[model samples]
Target: MQLLALGINHHTAPVALRERVAFPLEKIKPALATLRSIWTSGSPEAAILSTCNRTELYCAVEGKASHETALEWLSDFHGVDVSHLAPHVYALPQSDAVRHAFRVASGLDSMVLGETQILGQLKDAVRTASEAGALGTYLHQLFQRTFAVAKEVRGQTEIGAHSVSMAAAAVRLAERLFEDIARQKVLFIGAGEMIELCATHFAARRPAELVVANRSAERGTRLAERFGGRAIALSELPNRLHEFDIVVSCTASTLPIIGLGAVERALRARRRRPVFMVDLAVPRDIEPEVSALEDIYLYTVDDLGAVVREGNAARQAAVTQAEAIIENRVDHFMQWLDARNVVPVIRSLHTQADEIRRTELDRASKMLARGDDPQVVLAALSQALTNKFMHGPTHALNHARGETRDQLLSLVPTLLRQPER
Candidate 1:
């Protein structure tokens, strides 16, 4: 079987195309099952890692499997145009796949250089695949090593220190717009991890009023209570949006929830007070057109990439250390995979040796049954076994001529060497 990693990410594709190929949370298991079905023989073991910034499919497949087939399946599943995605899609094989997985799990591949959330996302993806019975030895080993590499990178380097995360970046940008964040009202849409993170950062400044708006009031209320804030139904955004100076939204809705008209009305309600908005959702909870309006500052997931990348030069020392750790781990994993290459040959050798042993034992048992002397029969058995073991090499060496004979002469002793006493 061949190891493969195939997908697209922020560097290779724009958000417009990235969102097009995203796999829904509930569809991951079924998608893995379907991915396995395409194989003509036993299904390939597979797992998928889909996050806001990337979607990657890792699989251990038969050599006959086609990369194009897997690519087409992704495009078909997401209702995306294969032609458009083909340009951005990448396929990594063998050691490259091993290295890519290691890099990704270590946070070196994230949009924000050393963010740790990707590691958690990857763990969740692997768990889902395991629960779906889609992971086998090859992929299981690869991911296990990936996690080890990540831990090594984290423990051995300061890669995550001094790095600006998207959540932190949002707060920094908010600070630039408002003189005192503690005096401004902050509203967070959605109760997901990103929202919780942004809320934590905003709450640290003790915003005058903090609110969480979510489709599920129960969840929203739970998160709000933890941060000393209030919860509101998503439906109340139109009326309440005007009260908050900073609005940070991240929801799972496939379409824009906050449109330009909604913001226009909210602006009028505030008498055109400046409002800072961050749309962290992939499909975008807030509409892009809202940025065109005066007295409104709108930012999307892509927009934060630049802000979060600040002080990248300072992180270079940590990056260099982390990369060295990953490189060593990749070498170790590749060596394990390379050892698997000779497994079939090893199995075949055992099978052949076992047959020879059984044949010799049967002959000795028959002679003893015929009333032959035990000592003679045992001696004959040992000689017969030795001759049989040596026959093939003897025949080849004697028959080989010139250079071939010389080569056989040099190799035979090595192949059938006797250990020194």
Candidate 2:
């Protein structure tokens, strides 16, 4: 089987194209099943990772399939044309696929280098695919090793320590407006991983109060409990909008969840008290017009980019070392895969040798049963079995000519020798 990775991310595609190809979390499992069916005939292993920055598909398949086939499948699934996506899509095979996955898991491929959230996102994707029965031995092992490498890289290097994370940058931007984070009432909209991360950082400040609002009250409540906060339904936002000083929202909604009117009401409710808002959502949970309001400090994902770019110079020094490590790991993984590819041939050789052994042994047993000398029968059986196993390769090596003959001569002795102790 061949390993492949096919998708587009922040570097290769703009947000417009990324959004068009993005897979909502709920649709991932069925989508994976469908992808496996389309590519693998019946039994195939596949996983998908879709975040604000990227959407990727990793799979193991039986035969070579055109890269366009996967691209066409994605276009059809998203109800878009293949031509529209061709400019942004990237398809990597075997070693390139392995390297891409390692870079992503290690956060080298993130918009903000050394960001740790992608690792969890990748884990969640693997879990979902496994639950959907779309993950098998090959992919499960691949992801497991990917996670290990990510942990090793982070633990051994200063990659994360010197890098600026989006969450930390959000906190820095919020600090610009509010003198003390502890005095502010923080509100987080949506219970996804990004929101969860922002909440964790904000919670560390021990804000006066923390509130989590979501479409699902249960999920909201569960996340709220972690930070000593309360949960509110999404519908309750308009009435309670102005109560908080800071609002961070990241939802998968295709449209704005918080609009101009809502922020206006909140501003009026707070008597024009300054409010800090961070909208990490892709389609933008908070309307852009809300940023125009006085005393309303709003920042989108793009706005955070500037803040996270500050310490990138320090990270550049570590890039060479990290890349070397990744390259070595990639070569090691490819060697393992090459060994796996030859397993069937090795198994066939063993089976043929066993068959010859059994046939010779049976003839020897019959000679013994007929009262022939047991020693003579055993010697004949051993010689016959040895000749049968060596005949084909020995003949070929003797008949070979030119460079091929030299290569066979070099390999034949090793092939014929007993395995070392």
Candidate 1 regions with alpha-carbon error over 4 angstroms = 371-384, 387-414, 418-421
Q: What does candidate 1's lDDT look like per residue over 283-355, in tens digits?
A: 6688888999999999887888888777577888999999888888889888888787679789998898889
lDDT of 2: 0.87
Compute the lDDT of residue 403 as modeled in candidate 1: 98
Off by over 4 Å in 2: 41-43, 171-187, 199-212, 218-232, 238-247, 259-277, 283-299, 366-376
lDDT of each: 0.89, 0.87
> Using alpha carbons, what is the TM-score of model 1?
0.90
Per-residue lDDT of candidate 2, residues 1-421 (tens digit): 6888999887788665677778888899889878887874535789999988888989888778457778888999998788888888899999999889988998888878888888999999999999998887778878887888888778767777677878889999999888899999999999988889899999999999999999999999999999999999999999998999999999999778999999998899899999999988766688889989999999877678788888777887566667777888889888988887789899998898888888888899999999999889988988897788779988887788999999988887777687879
Q: What overall lDDT, based on C-alpha atoms, would model 1 receive against the true structure?
A: 0.89
Candidate 2 has what TM-score? 0.82
RMSD of 1: 2.8
Clashes in predicted model 2 = 0
Give the C-alpha miss distance for residue 366 in model 2, angstroms.
4.1
